[model samples]
Target: MHRFANPGRFLRLAGAVLPWLWATALAVTAWGTAWALLYAPADWQQGETVRIMYVHVPMAWLAMGGYLGLGILSVMSLIWRHPLADLAARELAPVGAAVTALCLATGSLWGKPMWGTWWVWDARLTSVLVLFFLWLGHAALVRAFDETERGARAGAILALVGLVNLPVVKFSVDWWNTLHQPASVTRLDAPGMHVDMLYPLLVCAIGFSLLFGAIVLARTRSAVMERRIRALEMARARRADRPLAAAPATLAGD
Candidate 1:
């Protein structure tokens, strides 16, 4: 981890891994989509509409997973003062927000038919909505201050504060009365679904996870380079602004 904390080392490692990550993400997602849409049978109740779960579930999982990732990165940045960690956190916010939006949109599309409404204010739904707002707020706060460090500190605090709701979102159906369904795919004992459906679901989940990893890696690399360029430009500007001292006698003569 310390080795990766060094920008030079991280850049080297990223350069080596980027190609494979992109390739694997593309291949896995293609197979996963084919398996989920073509091979998996329609649900008895929801019929073909249940097929939406393949995309919806993975997006929901990634939305939560992305926020958790940001929280961890925020902690690392605040405690260790790792610039790279801050950069990673900043870079990941938009991606997480996008995933969260996808989850909500797809959930609505799936709900209109079954739930008889485009939206609901159930515990799980409300909590996840709050999560999405938190992501947007944190991203905004990160850029609000003129000082970058100040902005990062504010963002970190907000991230940690919002994290308190994650567990509640995870167990909302069990902890309180809610319209949202309880854990179906992941249970204390075993998953609820049969292998016929579970395998493709898992494949889609893996593909989504891989896609997230690749995107984050690429975004983080861009952030690092942008920071480096900013630093260099600032240094050059400062040097240009400084007045030249009187040269040494020999140099002045030359």
Candidate 2:
């Protein structure tokens, strides 16, 4: 892990893994989408409306999971001072935010028919909304300062503070009287969702997770390359300025 910490080494590793990640993400997501929409049996109660779970559930999972990853990155940045963690977190924010937004949108769509409303202030929904806002806040805060280091530090602090919301989001359905259903796939004894729908939903989740990883990894690679290019350009400019600065001294010596 220490050896791989070098930017050059990480870039090489990402270069190799990216091609496979991209291929697998595309293939799996496409298959999962098809399976969910075209083959999976519709719900007994909600019928076609239940199909939204294929996307919604996975988005929910990713939103929470990705924030956990962000929290880890924040720790790395603030504690260990991991060189790449800040950049990785920066790259991860928009994607995480997008997935959370999708989760909210799909949940609303699913709720419309069942609850007869497009929006509600239920505990589960409200916590997830806060999660969404936290993601947005981190993203915007990280770019707010001219100095990237300052921005990263601020973002890291914010992420750590926002970590408190995760537990609230997870347990809201259980702890409160919410319209949202209790744990289905993650129940202690057994999942409440039928096996028929469960399998396809799991596939969609895996695909989304893979796609999320691929996107973040690709973005981090680009950021590293751009930073390297800027360093080289600055070095070149400094070298070019040296001769101009020395010209008067050279003339006086002559």
Candidate 3:
């Protein structure tokens, strides 16, 4: 992990891996979408509407997974002072928030047909909404301070603090009576979902994770380059501000 602290090395590694990541994500997502929508059998209960699960479940997983990543990065940044960690966390926030919003939106769309409503105060839904707000709050905090270091520290703290919401989001369905169903793919004994539905979902989840990684790496690399440029410009300006060395006094005798 410390090896990746150097932005140049990280950038090189990212460059090498990005193409493969993007290709895998695209290929898997395409295959999963086709399988989920076209070939997978409809749910016995929900029928055609269950197709939305492919997109919704993956987005929800990534939404929570993204924040979990952010929290870990924040810890690395704050405790170990990892140079790239804060940048990665900063880049990840918006992506997590976007996915969280999509989760809510798709869940709502799925709900309207099955639950007979577009919105609900269910524990799972409410907790996820809180997670989304936490992401927004972290983003705002990261930009709020005039000093970048201060902002980063503040954001890191916010991120760590917000981790309390993660378990709530994960276990809300079990802890409270809600319209949302309990865990399907994750179970102590065995997955509740059928193999037909589960396979495509697993594929889609992997694709989403890859996509998230690619986006974060790209954004972090951009941030590092921008910071490097700013540092160079500052160096140039400092040099420009210095008085030109006094011309050496000419020796008339020479």
Candidate 4:
């Protein structure tokens, strides 16, 4: 892990893995989408609207998972001064935020049909909403400082602090009376969902995870390249600023 902190090594590893990641992500996502949309049976009660679960659940899972990863990376960056960890955390923010937004949007879409409302202030929903804000806040804070190092440090601190919300998001439904359903797929007992619906959901979740990995690797590679280019440019500018050594002095009228 520490050895990979070098940008060049990280880039090489990222390049090697990215193509396979992308291919797997695309293939599985396509297959999962087809299976869920075409093959999975409608819910006995909710009917076709249950199909949205394919997208909604995966996005929600990733939203939280992505943030948790970012927070862990933030800790690494702050504690060990891992070179690429901050960059990786920075790259992950927008993707996580987008997924969180999708989760909220899909949840609203599902809620409108079943709950007869587009929004709710239930504990689970509200906590997830807070998670979204935390993503946005971290992104903004990373850019707030004039110095890049300062910004990264500040963003890392914010990420660690924001981690308090993750538990709240996870346990809110269990702790409070909410419209949101309790844990079905991750329960202690057998999953509540039937195998027909469960299999495709698992496929979609794996695909989404792959997709997230591919995107983060690509983005981190780009960031490493950008930093390298900036360093080279600054070096060139410093060279240009240095005065040339005075021309060899010849003895007067040798």
Candidate 5:
């Protein structure tokens, strides 16, 4: 991990891997959508409306997963000073936030027909909302300082601090009397979902994860290039300010 901290190495590696990652993501996403929407049997309760879960559930899963990834990257940045770790965390913020927002929007859409309301202050919902805000906060904090390094450090600390919400969002249904249902997908006693439905959901989840990775890597690479350009510009500015040597002819004349 530390060796890969070198930007050149990182970029080369990413360039090699990104093509495969994107291809896999697109393939899986397409197959998953078809399987879930066309072949998977409808829920006994929600019927056709249950198809929304195909998108909603996976995005919700990725929302939390992306944050956890960012938090872990933050820890790595602070502890090991990995050059790209802060960039990774900073880049992950908007992607995670977008996914979380989608999760909420889709949830609300699902909720309207199922729960009879567009919004609720229930445990799972509220914690997920907090997760979105945390992402926003992380992005804002990282850019709040003139010193980019300091801002990155401050943002990393804030992200680690917000790690508490991840578990809360995960177990909210179990820990509280909420409107949300308990884990159907993740259960000790066999998945509450049939294999037919579960496979497509899993495909979609994996696809989303890969897509998130591709986006984050692309963003981080752009950030690193920007940083490099800024450093070069600063160096050039300093060089321009230096006094030039007087000509020998002028010295002789004086």
Candidate 6:
């Protein structure tokens, strides 16, 4: 684990793997979309509107999963001082927030036809909204301080505290009376969805998960490179300044 934490080593592995990840993600996601949108059996009750599940369900799952990841990264940052953890978490939040927002947007689109409204204060919906805000908050807080370490520490703390909401979001529908539907894909006894629909949904979930990883890894790589460049520039500037400082002392001595 420590071996993988080195920024240089991580960057090398990411570069080698990212192309494959992107290709696989695109192929799988396209196949899943094709299956879901065209061939998969629509719900007997909901008919064509059920098609939204392919996109919305994946987004919903990713949103929660991403937050869980952020929490883990936070734990790493706080406990082990994993060198890359802070940077990874910092890169992850915006992507997570974007995914969460898509979940909310897609949910609204799905809900309007089913529930006859664009918004609600239901437990599940509200908890998810909170999760979205938590993502945004981490993203913002991490950059708020001038000192990067201080910002990272603050963000890690916020991420750890925000993890309490995960269970609440997961169980909200079961725990409270809400228009939002219960878990179908992740049901304990058995999946509630039909095999045909379920297969494509699973494919989409896997594909998007890959895509999420690719995006985060790409962003982190860029960040590492950028920071390295800035450090080099600062070092060069200091080196150039040293000559000027020495000249004044030499002239005073003369």
Residue lDDT tens for model 6, 178-240: 999888888879999889999999998888888999999999999988888999999999999
Best by lDDT: 2
Cα lDDT for residue 119, candidate 5: 94
Model 2 has an lDDT value of 0.94
Model 3 alpha-carbon miss at residue 201, Å: 0.7
Runs in model 1 with CA error above 4 Å? 243-254
- Candidate 1 displacement at residue 60 in angstroms: 1.2
Give the TM-score of each candidate. 0.94, 0.98, 0.94, 0.95, 0.93, 0.98
- Write model 3 residue lDDT over 1-254, tens digit each, in one string: 78878888988988898899889888988888888889999999999999999999999999888998998999998899776888888889998999999999999999999999999998899999999999999988999988888888999999999999999999998999999999989999999989999998898888788888888888998898898899999999888766443223334335
Candidate 3: what lDDT? 0.90
The better-scoring model by TM-score among 5 and 6 is: 6
How many pairs collide in each candidate, listed in order?
Answer: 0, 0, 0, 0, 0, 0
Task: Select the stronger candidate by TM-score from 4 and 6.
Answer: 6
Which lDDT value does model 4 have at 105?
98
Misplaced by over 4 Å in model 6 are none
Q: Candidate 1, residue 106: CA error in Å?
A: 0.6
Q: How far is candidate 1 from the true structure (C-alpha RMSD, Å)?
A: 2.6
lDDT of each: 0.90, 0.94, 0.90, 0.91, 0.90, 0.92
